[model samples]
Target: MHIEDLAVPSVNMVRWGAPKQWLFVTPEQENVRAFEEKCRETFPWRKQARRPQRAATHCSQFVRHANVLVTTEALLDWGIDFSETICREGELVVTLPGTYHQVVNMGENLAEAVNVMWGNCGQVQSTYVCCSRDGCGHTGGVSQEDLTPEVASQ
Candidate 1:
């Protein structure tokens, strides 16, 4: 439900324990809109709020509490194309910019992640603009504090 840093790529290395299942959705406008609508329907309170926080897009908590998986087939029906992968112990996973992704650990897991900025300045600047417009707290090096209404309005 959330994207990694928009200007950087994230590398994840699983050192031990069980495998991790990852689901990714491309950052297409239609796909993101469909997923957001699904989230609002699943969590009705999100639709009731005047200005719901974007954190609601994080579906891991919902899946854990509701004990329901948002299946790939359902997403496909909603016109969302996705990619799935399983990363086992000692395996590495790399996520590129602008891709929304979710991860579920099959069991206990030990993993480490690092973000690397390798894009040109223009590309980085473009991501900053896109993230800012999208109100994406995790992207373009934006910190949570920067997303506050007061700060965001400035």
Candidate 2:
């Protein structure tokens, strides 16, 4: 799917809005650790900087108390590219921590997605019980016992 830059940052994985799901990124595409160091060296993310290398925060919260949406140019200046990109069928998409990006479907389609969160962030745990479908949270609120994979397998 083709991702057009909406000049905003958001997560749209495994989505069914308007058509299909979408995913999106930058920073020399370095390894997670190097990228985190790069961000610390390049920008003053401060509080947000402390998030894990694989961690990602919305543009609104990427900066501390900025209270303003982040601009593509602003991200670009920090050596993070915010250009429009495409994800072919079955290809995996990943977004970097603290970078701003957009994801949109080019046509009607079907796909799956997963989310990884850094343990350091605030409320690292989900408030609601997760869906039995592994990695597909936010949809199920089963009791803790039923949410377990063993019970799900049975």
Candidate 3:
């Protein structure tokens, strides 16, 4: 079939709606060791609204539906981590439906950004389960999953 032969419906057509969204800002995008150092950073971390990173380590969270992450400044990376970026006014990262990622504030302003999720119209499902002892507790989050290899092989 031709590329245009495939028929996928648009989210606006259905009354389903978009994914959840929120803005985030942090002081330093700390590594595993400097994790504690970030506590002293001057970003806003509301005690009640604090949601731990949803990955094996402190990485960015993925949105269930489609999302547009607009950063106020440039971003830094961790060794070889990869993400989708489109730079216009600032930098807009159009993340894969559900891909695991992390970010560092290469820019100056703490780290400001807005995320919009497209809920049901999104692609895969992601699961971040925390299985730690100390009876501290375990939790998991479901988002979309990555579809790179599956699409690339074709």
Candidate 4:
């Protein structure tokens, strides 16, 4: 991942690639829309139930055609500063609501991430802009009521 990475609110654990670099934008509600738009420019989040987490990998054709090199410029244009951080192995990066972050693996490596919203994590008006044409998206508030408390990967 070069730049222009779009992600939802979550925590990322570095299982490998100790010296991984990350790009982040301190999410301001007014700026989230623009930030998401910039990310969409590079990787559009579409497809059945697919989130931004899958765009960079699952959408091969889009990835090939998208010019993500302009990510830095896009971030700046949106009044969003892309902050870089390097995490060592076994480090966990927690993202607060309304913040946007991206990870760049130094090389072939493994990493695990989980997306969760704490019930007491305060209210962020946690909004996600979905590009789905299936009508499950909105540009504003996604409250706790919108999420489930458990997961079944099977």
> Whose TM-score is greatest here?
1
TM-scores for the candidates: 0.59, 0.30, 0.26, 0.53
| Model 4 CA deviation exceeding 4 Å by range | 1-8, 33-70, 122-154
Count clashes in each candidate, considering only residues at least 3 apart in sequence or on different chains.
Answer: 0, 0, 6, 1
Model 2 per-residue lDDT tens digits across residues 1-154? 1111211122334343234332224524363234344444545544333433312232222322222333456455655444555656655556543343445566776655443333332122232223222222323465555533345447
Candidate 2: C-alpha RMSD to true structure equals 11.7
Name the regions of candidate 2 deviating beyond 4 angstroms.
1-81, 118-154
Name every residue pair that clashes in candidate 1: none
lDDT of 1 at 18: 91
Cα lDDT listed for each candidate: 0.60, 0.38, 0.26, 0.50
Tens-digit lDDT string for candidate 1 (1-154): 4555433468898899999998887667787667756755775654323324334334322222222446788778877778999999999998876566778889998999886555331144222322233333334576644533345346
Q: Please list the residue runs of candidate 1 whose C-alpha ends up more than 4 Å from where it truly belongs after superposition.
A: 28-30, 37-44, 47-70, 121-154
C-alpha lDDT (0 to 100) for residue 57 of candidate 2: 34
Candidate 4 per-residue lDDT over residues 1-154, each given as its tens digit? 2212123357777787546778767666566556555555645533323443334333322322243443666667767656778777788777765455556677766777666645644332333223232233432464334443432111
When sorted by lDDT, best at the front, the candidate numbers are 1, 4, 2, 3
Which of candidates 2 and 3 reaches a greater lDDT? Answer: 2
**Candidate 2 accuracy as lDDT:** 0.38
Mind giving the per-residue lDDT tens digits that candidate 3 earns over 1-154? 0000011112111112222232232222343223222222322242213244222123222121112243333223222222332223333443333323334333333223433334442332233222222111232331122332344235
